[model samples]
Target chain A: MNIYIGAENIISPLGSTAEENFGALSKNSSGIKKTEAAGFDKKSIFFSRFAENTNDFSFDALLKNCLKNVRSKISPDIFSSEKTLLILSTTKGDIKSENVNPIGKSVSELQNSFELKHAPIVVSNACASGVIAINTAANFIRAGVYETIIVAGCDVISDFVTYGFECLFAISDKPCAPFDKNRTGITLGEGCAAVVLSSHKTIFNVEPMRFIEGTSGNDANHISGPSRTGEGLYRTVKKTLELAGITEKDIDFISAHGTATVFNDDMESVAFDRLNMQHIPLNSLKGYYGHTLGAAGIIETAICLQSMRNNTLIKSMGFEEEGTVKKINIISENKKLSLETVLKTSSGFGGVNASLLLKKS
Target chain B: MNHLSSYCHISTKEIVTDKGALLFDNTEGLEVNDFLKTVYKKLAIDYPKFYKMDSLSKAAFLGVELLKKENAALAEYADDEIALLFANSNASEDTDKKFVNSYAEEHAPSPSLFVYTLPSILMGELAIRNKWYGESLFVILQKFDAAFFADYCNMILLRNAKACICGWIEITEGKTEAFIFLAEKNGNENNTPLTKQTIEKIYKTIMKQSRPSKV
Candidate 1:
């Protein structure tokens, strides 16, 4: 069963929609900027972002736009009430009520906003939520549960998460430099991406990107931090390859979850070293998209799929001098290649980790 | 061929299962931490940080332990030998609210509390408790889908996972509800074929039955 990721819709710092965002990627632009939210003003944190709020882009509007984009690309009749599942990955999932309206504390009030009558599954797995959302949809496809599953991951930089990261002392007050020697902390950003996966071999006279295989694991080594040895990540990467019947050499490009945090970059470097994939052209989209939290996996995965279709890999924007971690060939500039398969890897708090293999059809 | 034979449900003030007897049932809705402390007292388990663990951690802690007691063979598997999947309707929104409130007040957010905000942490805690770690996944759904539940079990078995814990847990407004089942693959060379009809029938029956703990 070929799970196709067709018509990825994204809204990030660069711009909204795949065309706008990918245009920025191709031009080597940086989306990290000083945030102007009232929440940030109260806090002393300087460097952060809220996705450029284009006119009339509310949460509902974003969903409607994403659905519209996908609708234009795929046939509506395909999803005619056959239990087409909608699995969402998000952290700041309409959580304004809990912050504004003081109730006894329930997340359900926030979840109530995600009631898509056609698509009704939501996943809030912290940073790895997006990958898990994709995994959830793909598993349903493999299990023959639903014919079509729409995996959408989106999160806005809310006062809830923004100040929460600030309180943890993990937010960078300056532009984030992922994998850099002097990297201080992570910069937050917002984006939403929706991917439609189906058991159909092809769709709409287009060959959708194929989801070959993927794996997820937990280090159980820490509650908030990742393993220094990258044991969980290494195991997940190896298992992903094994399940896909591919090898380290088979992966053409590596889309790393480089959040510009000190620990995550270091840990991922060790994981890549163990996998003997150091020379692979690797880059993190965090510099461009900021850390979209739960949406990072889907947002980055969408970009990689777009790049695969165009046969080009976007450069890592903020990477310059190598950090204290092991060295890899970071794509500092856009490059063209016969990229067949790309590996998208992400690790999050609670020692949760995941890697997905995407192949160009 | 994995099937949910029996299951259990635990909340802030109740422990309901198909044991034909009530373990503990109370109407007073204890706070999240205090409820977990009660779980410790009743189960006679010793861990200094019982109250400090996250909701998923506490729930998975209780679910896996009770599951082990029912099926002791679960202990023999390797770290990644068995599969664990969790579905939450609303994950850690309360925690996120608390963290934000604390941050708004300039208080240092506890990493311990930050840890539970992720829905998958519960499954991780279960893996750490028992060495079984074959394939683990955590999902947040608006609600449980019987078809998706059965589909998940089939994939776990197809991926060669020996046993799977497939269920849902939700904690909101001082109320926590969790349902966990220990499902092992059918020994048959061919998996037990479960179609939508059989799953819906099971769901209808289970939905209508009264709480065994209350009985």
Candidate 2:
């Protein structure tokens, strides 16, 4: 069974639609900006936030907006079809809510508003939630469990999450510079993005790319820190390539996680080098969107699809110099290339790492 | 179809096996930590890292330990063959509240508690303890849905994993309920096939027995 992914939608600080976000990226524009007195201690912190001046940037609103945007790009019947399933990926969904389960209300609301046939499943695997959710969609579609799956990843910026990262000193003082020597840590961001995966390609109003294969692996090492050897990442990428029946040589571009955290970037570099993909052109979208936590993977994959459609490789924003010990080719400037296949990888807390292959249809 | 090899249930009061046999009961008026510590001591597993995990992780760890004890065949499988699929209605709520209090009520935020705010951290703990680098997924559903679990387990087994350790572990408001089950491709003739009815039956039995009618 061929899983076709299309009708991508990204509602981020950059733009509302996928193409608009990609256009901003092509122009070297970043959504990250320093917000005065945003930190826990009233310190100025850098974060990519939706430009909407109102505090109405709630999780439920973002999810609805992203889904509405996605609905415009795909067949309307799929939303209410029994054979279609919805999967939501988020880390801390509406953390500020008084209810203990922050995601339940939003899931119910989305189901009711969209008239979904089935209750949505919410994946909350830290940052890997988005990638893993997409992979789960592919798995379900291949198994004939659902003919179509709508995977939406969303996370809103809240004091609970921001302060938590601030306490860990993981928040970068400036816009995140992934794969760069001066990169300090992640600049947290917020956004909602979604992609549709279906066995029937004709369902998409536009040409849908093939979702070749996706898999996840655990480092089995540390919960908070990445593996020094990139054990989990290497294994996941290796398994993904093996499942896809393709070699590293077949991957034209790599959308690396590159969270800009020193340890994370180093771990990714080691994994790529171990896979003998040191020279493959790779870029991290974190520099543009900041680390959007759960939304990072979906938004990045949507950008990857946009890049394939445009035949342009967007540069790794804020990446100016080599930082990792194992040298991997980092895209410093936007370049036009004949990109046929792209590998998207993400590594997050909990020793979790996920990788998936997307090919031009 | 996969086989439901073994399962274990952990509630606030007792730890029971899949067969509805009580393994351990909390008679010491112990809280979550003390209850977990008592179970850990009874099991005689000496892993210092267990003390550092949140309540959610501890419940999952204890449940897996009990499952492994019941089904020794699980130990025979190679690492990276067992996928961990877990879901809960209240995802890390206990830890999330603690983290929130750490910063809002308390003067400083605790990094240790903040790290466990995500429910998947429990999966990491299990992976680190067992050294299994297989696929892991942590989902938050409205309630325990047996059909979803059955369908997802079948899909996972078909894809990459040889077996799956699936659970619906919910810990919140000083109450805990964890039902962890092991699903394998083939099992002994006596083993039941992993189906929606079987999972729902087990969950209902445990929930009913653990929480008797108030009347």
Candidate 3:
């Protein structure tokens, strides 16, 4: 089934909404900037950030805002209590409260901010949650349970995320480089993205930007680290391609997860090479959008969908030199191409890997 | 066939099926942790490592033991044929809180405390223990959904997994509570059509009977 994702809103170091985010992507402007957080003793940390103006935003309010913006653009009557299922994904939902306790509370003790507002289904599978959420929603829609399903994902950077990454020495103090050999560590960012999928692709007059054919897999390796062989990612991409009923040759552009970290980039390269897709044009949005964590998957999906709609492609920011894994062609400059399909993949802390195939409609 | 091979719940030592009971009530309190010590002791696991494990891992530890005790007919098959699926609320908020709290006080976090942050780690630990290298997933939905469970099980079966170990495991405070069932491929040609109602019916009944009545 072809799933349509329309009208996305993002709060990243790039920009808050699609307009700002797109503008930043076109200009090759990065949202990563130096900030003095409370806990870190370091003078500065480079973060691809979304403004933390969430004081006025409740879980319900955020959902409503996303709904409101999307609703205004699309037909509101299409989703009026029409048995729409919501599958929301996030790495840190209301982690600000957890930062107060060092030992952590039990599952029942944790406050579920998203549950308090909307009755949508939630996912927190580390970084892989975003793509899984979309894939799950797509499956639900494809199964004919709900006529339409709402896929929303978000995560905010806080002391917990910062300190957690810092403990692992994964945070880079400067803007990230997607596939660059000199890349150091990832820069954390915050953002939210919402996509609506319907069973009938012709619901809205707008042509379907992309068709979601994605899959999720677990590596069963180290918990915090990605699999050294990229087995998880390799399998995920393979599964995604299998489900899409297409091989690697059908994909035009690759929206790489490209956290610009050492192990991650190398692992992605191995997976791409195994698929015999090293010649594909690829770049990481993290260099432009700042690793949005949970939101990165859906946000990048939206960006690719939009690029497909506009018939334009963007380049990887801060990508100076190619890394050791020299299989794929990294997009160095913005280029226009006949893009029919794009492959976007994300690997998270847990041995979780997810990949999605989106086609230009 | 797609029948109950063998399933167990270590907490309270009471294993109930649609047919009858295996053990009597042993402990009190709505908490899940009260009886986890027995699980640790029975498994002969180290206290410090056991204490440091997350609720899902502990629940998984107990679940795997139950699967082994029953040693269903399907256990003789390939280990990769068995799938593990978990569902829970609260997700990893507790671990996140602990992780954040570590840095919250001083901003410096110990790597040891940082390990259990992901909810799926429990699944990984359980895999390492059982060597069950089949399909696995950790889903966090609002409350619980039977359709989701049924759908996931069907997907596993579609992937041609020989058997499945699936359930809901939730723990808060020190309390751990779980209800898991082993499902095998059934019928001639090894096919069984299971619905959301089938899984939910057994889940609700086992879960209700496992807990002491309020009265």
Question: Residue-wise lDDT of candidate 1 within A1-361, one digit each (tens)?
Answer: 7777777878765777887888899998877777554444464444434445464445545555665676566765654446476777776564562453221122233224433335366676668778877876887788777777777777766666675676567888777888877778888877678888887755543568888887777776766777888887888898889888888889899999998888989999999998999999999988787888877998888898789878988988788889847777788889899889999998887677888899877
The alpha-carbon lDDT assigned to residue A330 of candidate 3 equals 86
Residue B70 lDDT, candidate 3, scale 0-100: 51
What tens digits encode model 3's per-residue C-alpha lDDT throughout A44-162? 78886645665534333444556556555555555554557666777666566434322113122222422222356666667877787777777666666677766777766776677
Please state the error at residue A130 of candidate 1 in Å: 1.6
- Which candidate model has the greater lDDT, 1 or 2? 2
Interface RMSD per candidate: 3.4, 1.1, 3.5
Sliding window of 10 residues with minimal summed lDDT for model 3 chain A = A102-111
The whole-model lDDT of each prediction reads 0.71, 0.91, 0.68
Q: Each prediction's TM-score against the native?
A: 0.89, 0.98, 0.86
Q: What is the TM-score of chain B alone in each candidate?
A: 0.82, 0.95, 0.78
Superposed by TM-score, candidate 2 places the C-alpha of residue A282 at a distance from the truth, in angstroms, of: 0.4
Docking category of candidate 3: acceptable
Q: In model 2, which residue pairs have backbone atoms overlapping below 3 Å? A: none
Model 1 DockQ class: acceptable
Q: After superposition, how far is residue A203 of candidate 1 from its true place, in Å?
A: 2.0
- The Cα error of candidate 3 at residue A79, in Å, is 2.8
Show model 1 residue runs off by greater than 4 Å. A36-55, A81-83, A97-118, B25-32, B104-111, B131-134, B187-215
* Residue lDDT tens for model 2, A1-361: 7889999999888888998999899998999888899888999999999765775467888898889989988887889999999999999888782554668888999999999999999998888889999999999999898999999998888888898899889999888999999999999999989999999999999999999999999999999999999999999999999998999999899999999999999999999999999999999999889888998899999999999999999999989988797999999899999999999999999999999999988
Candidate 3 lDDT over residue span B1-215, tens digit each:
25444445544434443335554344454245446655566656553645667666776776676566656465586755677677777666566666666766756696766777767677666655655545566777556677777766665565436677776766655445567767666523432346677676766766666667434
